[model samples]
Target: MPLSAASRPGGAGLDFARVLMEVPHGRLSGTLLVTGDPGGRFHLENGVILEVTSPGSPGVETLLLRSGRVTETDWASAVRSGAAGWRVGAELVARELVGSAELQLICAMAALDGALAMGMGRIDRVALDPEPPATCFAAPEGIEPEWLSRESERRIRALGGQPVSPFRDRLSRTDAGTRLLDDGIAGERRDILQRANGRRSSRDIAFLLGRGLYAVTVEASRLLHEGLVDVAPPALGAADGPAPAPEYGRNPEPTGQPGRTEEASRLPRRRPGTSGITGVLPLRPVSGPWRPPTALTAEDRRFGSAQ
Candidate 1:
């Protein structure tokens, strides 16, 4: 299917694409508003697909596909019919498209990209109707509504302030550290890293992975040490004050030991020269035998007379 392009009333160029996405929240339901113009592509996971609806915000002249409005097949057919168009690379998974997974994966990627782009101020906030499926709002001073969700707005703010790919060099510089994104690093790493967004502690990462605090501390430290990530200090004067110091390297050992030395100290000690016994029994020396005879003399004489 061809990728669609349009021009919004406000002089901003719009581009739209279709993708299948999988979100942690749920399965694929319908099409979503993808991006303004020249924004990064979004993807959720391998099995998800998403269809981009707006390359250019068409204003009232064109129809914007609202979230949760259509299915993957619906979007696919629309694209083939020229009513809608696919984004670049959307065609790759055309054969394997699974409604929920592919679409949601696409949504996740788009969500991340949208969040990042939103950070750059490419898009503005608009009034969104509050409901189970939240709405988003962003608009320039006097234009028609540009909707963004409260959550989406926050994500954009958090992601937009940082350098893209904080760990790219570290991931590439060494074999031991490089995730290489081999098979791609999109799963847990991406999930945790995105959530980290500078607010989470290394201990949090440790807990999340069920790993030792030291392990998580090292991993996070590696991310920072390699310059692939950074910690986000709390906003100035927020009532929360300073974020409490991270209790790093504090996760207890899996075997219930606080640390190795303490467990080793609890083991029973060996006593010197106690090989035969555990030293629970005392050793005694053997004595040579000696005979006693006075009480038996009378009985011995009688025995000899009878013989």
Candidate 2:
């Protein structure tokens, strides 16, 4: 569904990375709902990403099932029991089926994976669902938005030299491919290669493997470069053409200006107390008297001297 201007609040031009930058810096507490192609909801607390859920990718439940950590019956039971309160994690923990730490780790991975998948595609609209202060189950503590953006950029850079497009390219193993034993391919890549049948797109392979699109694409790209596989452009009646190149997390192009870096020269300086928006909660200023003490006080010094 298309998001209206009122729902987006941050304006239509804001992409995923930009939205992420704005939320954390503004310390906004709510769910940032992204719609269209690679849609998802980013749950934030004090501007930190607690969890991210995307319809385009496999969620925690699917990941757990595909990993063989939980049986389908067990997952179904948990979901049925926890549906009223949305406490599947709590249910599993209470039943001792999965450890709290393991659950947290899995959930964190799922959220990051979903976010990464969303990052690879276009973000059509962004809406804020203002939620009250509350605790989250299996939520990562204090995950910075900038860190996510940087990680996304790094992943994109890693795929910089890839010849096959992640969106449109369909891959098939080369006829020279042999059994898995001698070729040295193992783990996720092996699994991905096994499923590549010239019919499925990278997104399909990701869903089949319960892996992230970015990961599958990167691996497939490597395989293509190695001549182990071949890529075909989108067939007729395919989904929309390849999305525009990512905008927000990419490195800024040089303007050819002297004595200035692209980032330093082009980006606008964020004004203090700007709120980062006209509605909802305003950004909390970093400057304050509560800054950490740099050194021991006179009393502590005197006490140490006496000792």
Candidate 3:
């Protein structure tokens, strides 16, 4: 549906297209609208009204993966084969799976370009205006649940070229916390606390820290408790981002022991059998070679790897 400028508020431009979705029973194509985004959420009133977002540096693009378009297998394959993550988002475009123009749309959506409403389907009998997207879309009348879940996730990925629900929250510091603190937070912990500079979530940090998630959590919590770190609220979309290096030597003091290795005590102590476990201990002690704390202040990092 090509809506005139007058039909929309503030003369916002509108563009509509019909894309065929490859589904099991048969090909399913829905009418998608591309209206100027006042809010940057490349939102489309498609099957169930969806919002698409990206991480890291927000790009300019609109890669719509509708619920009725692809399959679960397609999404997993793209991810497992190292295809659909943010690093690969641009690659997918480069490979021509998505168009340059589409990329612009996706970017606009991510940035919340405008306050607008986009309709889906050949007709506009049912429309949503600035409505919160439906999390789990109901089948079109008679569609099966099995098919619904698969198609829903697929459509979700297709629209955003990303996963439906976020794998983790934005402010979380799972693994990266371990690494950045590995050499033992070189200076006062308070300096390394902001999330605005693009700190990675625990998942992203895990890859960098070369440590398990549990270990990272312990380290992050220790930093938080000792007033060295602060958990930033979740970003609007993806979690990982670069953070500005903090100043050091303002209060250089390694007050904690061996960098406060509290991995064993991070978990909450719970009663046995309460949560279905028969006989579970709250925590198990660890015995290993003690590694000295590694420095991690802005000055330490700038003064070469040796701090």
Error of 2 at 302 (Å): 52
| Residue ranges of candidate 1 with Cα displaced over 4 Å | 1-96, 101-105, 108-112, 121-148, 160-222, 225-307
Per-residue lDDT, model 1, residue 240, is 20
For each candidate in turn, the TM-score is 0.25, 0.66, 0.20
- Candidates 1 and 3: which is better by lDDT? 1
Q: Clash pairs of candidate 2?
A: none
Best by TM-score: 2
Worst 10 residues of 2 by lDDT: 262-271
Model 3 alpha-carbon drift over 4 Å, by segment: 1-199, 237-307
- The candidate that wins on lDDT is 2
lDDT of 2 by residue, 1-307 (tens): 2334423423432444456667666888877787644557777788776666775555666556666777778877877884425657667777777886666666655665566545454445667778643333445344556655554444443433356555546677776544552477788768877766665556556656665566677677767766777875444433343222222123223346422321121112112212112222222333322221223123323322432
Alpha-carbon RMSD, each predicted model: 33.8, 15.1, 20.8
Candidate 2 local Cα displacement, residue 141, angstroms: 3.4
Ranking by TM-score: 2, 1, 3
Tens digits of per-residue lDDT for model 3 on 26-63? 32223223322111222333332233322211222211
